[model samples]
Target: MDFEIREDRTAQGRVKLSREREAYSRLMQQGYTNAQACRVVGIDSRTGRKWRNGRSADRRQKAAPPINAVVPPSGPSRYLTEDERLHIADRLREKATIRAIAAELGRSPSTISREVRR
Candidate 1:
């Protein structure tokens, strides 16, 4: 038996279905529902279901972590006034943990650490 590939029906010009399927599978593994994965990969929900069911073969695991699961840039630090820096330093001198300082300032521990380290 011989099979002929259809040149005109090829996915060369658009995103490959295989790639989409893989991405869908990966998203599902990462806890995204089929609907959510479909929306992220820009495919119809039914198609996503089909891919998940193995009726089709688009099997591209998502190459990276989900966008929603990633931490977004927190943006630049607010310039601390001299008094504020002194206050933070004073708190640190008093042996306040980074968590304590961040809680007091309502910021992240990383922010507090960076501020004091500078």
Candidate 2:
């Protein structure tokens, strides 16, 4: 028996293949099924299934940054109370810049700007 293979003549063919490869690898690493990984990586279920079954041309997932090593910025302080706003406003009207007010109150320049604007 002879089998005839059809070739994809569309640009989506290669992109779909690459997506399937990426999705399948992530699925294996994250301990998810093809369908779940496909959902996460934005690929179709049928393509994901094929990749999971070892038709994948590539098998690498993008590594995420270490969560523990990530340093989130220290957020604005709650020290700028309503009373502080009244005082800062009084100071700004006395010709104090937002930076000066921020330094005096130990807040961000943006904080001072927002306070005066509001």
Candidate 3:
């Protein structure tokens, strides 16, 4: 079988394979599927699956973690606090727009929308 060699380039026209691998690994850590992460990283889905399943180019068993794998955060979220939620509720009662509430809380409009939906 012939395998295609793909080179990912940066915005400054620099080829960086390690950076692409890191991006793929990060996407996977974020719960993206192999195909989706491969699309985002500009690589073949087969390559992503191989990395995830810990297989070498010859398809032999080689268990190993991806390079530069980042550990996921395990602490309390730094997002909106209880006070902010209360403020958002008050603003909503006052018929304030989502954008207006977000601006007051220094957050994005989608953040306010998601909070209200919750």
Candidate 4:
């Protein structure tokens, strides 16, 4: 089937190909495979690939954040709060194991043991 690109090639034979890209997008949305859409649009398969998976313009944009980035603390850390202190006190009264309270508070057993020792 001869599919003529209806977009005006007014840019001196270098067609804008926006129409072809649009057609490719539609064909893909309608469940056509990548190669099939490219063939139907009369564009190179590579062109369709570039359209579907766009090229990153800037390499720096993909770089990971700095290692020393100072992200603010989202929760209690470095010190146990008064609530944690109270819980530990109550658990100690009940003769609960250090590991048990640590598991409940999502802290290491050694941390709970050290806190009790302190």
TM-score of each: 0.34, 0.34, 0.39, 0.39
Global lDDT for candidate 4?
Answer: 0.73
lDDT, residue 77, candidate 4: 93
Indicate whether candidate 2 or candidate 3 has the larger TM-score.
Answer: 3
Ranking by lDDT: 3, 4, 1, 2
Candidate 1 global CA lDDT score: 0.66
Model 3, 52-105: lDDT tens per residue?
676444467545554546576564356889999999999999999999998887
- Per-residue CA lDDT of candidate 4, range 27-95, in tens? 877789989998888777876776777655575544322113234786559888889989999999999
The CA lDDT at 34 in model 1 is 84
For candidate 1, write residues 48-89 as lDDT tens digits: 665566442346643332223243446535766676678789
Q: Least accurate stretch of 10 residues (summed lDDT) in model 4?
A: 62-71
Output the better candidate (1/3) by lDDT.
3
RMSD of 3: 10.8
Query: How does residue 85 of candidate 1 score in lDDT?
Result: 73
Model 3: residues with Cα > 4 Å off, grouped in runs:
1-16, 56-118
- The better-scoring model by lDDT among 3 and 4 is 3
What is the C-alpha RMSD, rounded to one decimal, of candidate 2?
A: 14.4
Q: State the C-alpha lDDT per candidate.
A: 0.66, 0.62, 0.74, 0.73
